[model samples]
Target chain A: MTKKRLTPPLTDADIENLEIGDQVLITGTIYTARDAAHKRLVELLDEGKELPVDLKGQIIYYVGPTPAKPGQVIGSAGPTTSYRMDPYAPKLLAIGLKAMIGKGSRSQEVKDAMKKYKGCYLAAVGGAAALIAKSIKKAEVIAYPELGPEAIRKLEVEDFPAIVVNDCKGGDLYEEGVKKYQK
Target chain B: MREISVEKITRTVRDLCIEAACDLPQDVENLLRQAKEREESQFGRYSLEKIIENVELARQDTVPMCQDTGLAVIFVEIGQDVYIAGGNLVDAINEGVRQGYTDGYLRKSVVEDPVFNRKNTGDNTPAVIHTEIVPGDKLKIMVLPKGAGSENMGALKMLKPADGLKGVKEFVLKTVAEAGGNPCPPIVVGVGIGGTMEKATLLAKKALARKAGEHHPDPKYKELELELLEKINKLGIGPQGFGGRVTALAVHIESYPTHIATLPVAVNLNCHAARHKEAIL
Candidate 1:
């Protein structure tokens, strides 16, 4: 498979060019958020309050990284299950969230939002945190530090690998791959 | 009576926690290597290779393999003649967990309350301990750091006696199929049959500690395990649920006697990490 190198903030063209099952190596800046942080982000949106970080054309990684030991840029950091973020994803997508990086299948509603908004969803290898963390060059908590590991972090990554699970055209690797292999 | 100091117990528990988080058990690592060789999908094979690489990195660097260091679940078997001195056994175990999470730089995953307060416990103490009393003068301790990705997908069912084996198999298959990629495949499916509701659940969790690809000793249950494993792999959930021929490394079933009128079944899924370690004193 030919690997594509992407540097966010990704444009609509960047996401639309992707297809399910395409391998990608992402660089540049991405933000991290999990369940607690997502709840707060959505709550802020609901109340017409300002969000701590901008979502336009930005990628979000669903992860809660372990605390870094001395002399490390970051600890073992990998994707969490994506379904838990399904409830909040469409709202972010509506507000110009360009892509999501995590493991597992997204809900149909979230996929529909990706198609409607020209966004994409990617899958990082779960349980491969140490290998994944090696791609991250820098990390700093930017919002909701009170949430601890669930806080939003701005990360500078180089060649961070993931697979395109859902594309703007509504292709789903999980469903298609299962159909191809299932007996 | 054999006297063991509480300090010894605490120290052992702390060490086990640190060790288990950073290292993949040999059995699990071997299974993943085999899965990588057997995986049919290109993406699945790649995922397996990365997982294997991650394990090596974690071990070499003395860092956790995954960010979710998990809630500490300790299984202890105490001999009738062994005595724990200097402190209460439970408190000593919690103290060990506190030190392990703090010293190891593991994540503090536990919240003080499930619903209301939702405050981080900070130290990841008060492990979920399961204790059994046995014959000799030895203390056996096993530490399992269970991540929540797969744990959240566990299921239990109280079936009628008429449901029988066919219904049990169907339920197991359905649970895995519905879980799809959510539990972080490839997963280890632990099925507990018979017993009461809670016992069935505990048995399912206990089944996870068995060596990867190991089956039940009984011939009948062993056959059932193999059959279930075959069905699961056929689902094509693959590694990380992206789809392939290796959805699960093994299917383990543990069962006990049940009442004539009742049938209880539980299913627990463990992700590819399946981290655990043991020591006997």
Candidate 2:
């Protein structure tokens, strides 16, 4: 299948154009965060403090990459299950987060927020970390180094592949796909 | 009595950890390739292809196949005539895990406590070790780096004898269906029937260490395994749960005799990664 190429700093139009199950090849900058980082980011928001990184028009990848070996930009990095971030996702979406890249299904609250906020959720193939890493040209920890692998990192990616699992219109590929194929 | 140095055990454990992270065992790789070929859905085929490629890339670069390098789970079979010299076996295993996580650049995912502290353990030490005593003089060790995505999807049920086989099948199906896209399919379903609650869970985990597509020794259980595998794949959860004919690469069942009044069942899932490695000393 042909994949639509998407670059970060996505506009509302970009998100609206996506449909559940559409293949995408994402290019440009994305931020990395997982369970621990999400907790801290939400905490900062609750405290009425500035976030370490801006959420506006930015995409956050739910991943905790293995340590990079010598001479490598990053190690195998795949999407973790996305539901763990459901609690914090809507809050980020409210702040203008345009999209998220992760694996698995999102909760109803997060899906509703995506529809209301003109955001989308994309799924990178889980257990395909080495292939995903090939798309990342550079990575540097931008915050919470103490969180180790969970630290927030700025990544420059090229042709990073994902599928639109939840679209702004409230379509869910997971549910739709399973229904289509279930015997 | 045969004496084995703690130093040797530690070093071997360390090597196994690195190997388990970097290499997708041939059994798993072969199963994935077959699944890729067998998958009917276009998206499912695409996911499997990517998984296969990831395995190749991880092996070539000596990097982990997936970032969640997992909690180090060690299984050791100690011979009755053998003795571990120089240190306690548990400490030696933990030390090995420390060295391996650091040296291999694998992620340290363990938290010190489940609820209160929730602090990172730093080195992925304090491995969940299971020991069994056998009759030989050799020591056998197996390391399974279990990622959390699938691990968190595990389920257990204590049922009355009246529940029977029908209850077991329904429970397994419900667990996988509820899991949906979350457990990182196509998953290996490890089912444990009988035993006490904890024993059933352990048996389910041990089931994962078996070769994919291999059936239980008993003809009865093997037939049940095939039946369950068919039912699960028919669910169309697919690769990464996108929907396809290849939702499960295998269904493994390990059972133990149970009390007259009790029937306990546990399900443990391993993602497509399904990583494990072993050594004999």
Candidate 3:
């Protein structure tokens, strides 16, 4: 019932207080990576090698954007399905990745990871590529350019819209929202 | 026999690929409107509205409706009397996919192999093509840009004849309920009943290509579709599975005659952004 727009991401307490289905407009630095990049990062971790980017207090967007057209810094950037990244999320969270942005429900393992690591999961509007892209003030490829669209990129966003799907307090919006609406 | 130029098929197929990728089909647009009106939750209604807006932005601005541009799915109905002059029909379709994905600036998602190496193909070639020979001079082509999310959730089951319609419906509703928000709610449910295992799956996928809200020709199946839609919406999965009364925009069932003791069912889901385009040549 309560709604708030976060132009800049709030504290973990702010995220935990959000009810299921509460709309939020988030502004902050979010990193982009897809299946390929996640796999590589996890592998690097397994080898005890340093990662290309720092995970502390960072948000990882599950996206692979199209080539930027003309003058745009990024192309139709939107969230991919979250489940594909379920396997690696716990490890990333353990490493200090605080927030994950994607669409759809995360598995219990990911939710458990969020609770254990004091991390969160945010759901961006799925399929709203152009609208979502407008939020990005800056975007540049940071690593794995060989993966092209699937590469990891750094994006600075302002008022990027999202909803908290899972929070560190063991709350899950997708589950609660469904139960509330069950007819 | 009628001779058809390979060049024409190649070009037309490419057009279909791009069209299906960039634009949301009109029938689907209307169905989403209806679902929005019927949805009970404010969040579900809002989500549906966002989807409608996304389609317009994608169409007017020439951007992809979804980031997953999807795997190329080609459905070809070749006339028995027609002869393709220059090359193989399948090859022509694949070439069209390559050109369309590259030209449209869509994502190349397919891997060169499934098991190991799993290297990206760069250009999305080798479309999943289903070809059928029918009585006609013209070839009909339908392109469905099927995203991996819903496609990954697709399932096929073989049941004893005793299970019947109720069993089929339960399985479908369970799939949607279990999927929750994963496939992206306000989804279109495509059900294929009968046929062999893989054939049933193919038929289910093809069923999703139909215009949203349209029902099966058979009265019994149409009734089943309506019932399934009601049950799915009642699950309260809502838009993006955040709870709502309009979890499914529509349910479409396609069935075939089956063996005496066997019944088979396949469910293929298409998210709100169901992208499909067709052409005849």
Ordered from best to worst DockQ, the candidate numbers read: 1, 2, 3
Candidate 3 residue lDDT tens string, A5-68: 6533345665556655566666767789879899999999999999999877778899988767
DockQ for all models: 0.88, 0.87, 0.76
Q: Over the stretch B20-101, how does candidate 2's per-residue lDDT look in tens digits?
A: 9989999989989999888988889989999998999999988999999999999999999999999999999999999999
What TM-score does the predicted chain A of each candidate obtain versus native chain A? Answer: 0.99, 0.98, 0.91
Candidate 3 lDDT tens digits, B1-281: 89998888889888887788778888988888888888777777777888888888888988888878889998999999999999989888888888888888888888889898678899887799999999989899999988887888888889889998778988898788887787877899998999788878887998998988899999988899998888888898888887888888889888888899889999999988888899988
Q: Least accurate stretch of 10 residues (summed lDDT) in model 2 chain B?
A: B241-250
What lDDT would candidate 2 get against the real structure? 0.93
**Model 2 ranges off by over 4 Å:** none
DockQ, structure candidate 2: 0.87
**Compared with the true structure, what per-residue lDDT tens digits does model 2 show for residues A45-97?**
99999999998999999999998889889988999999999999999999999
User: How displaced is residue B268 in candidate 1, in Å?
Assistant: 0.4
* Runs with alpha carbons beyond 4 Å of true place in candidate 1: none
Candidate 3 chain A weakest lDDT stretch, 10 residues = A1-10
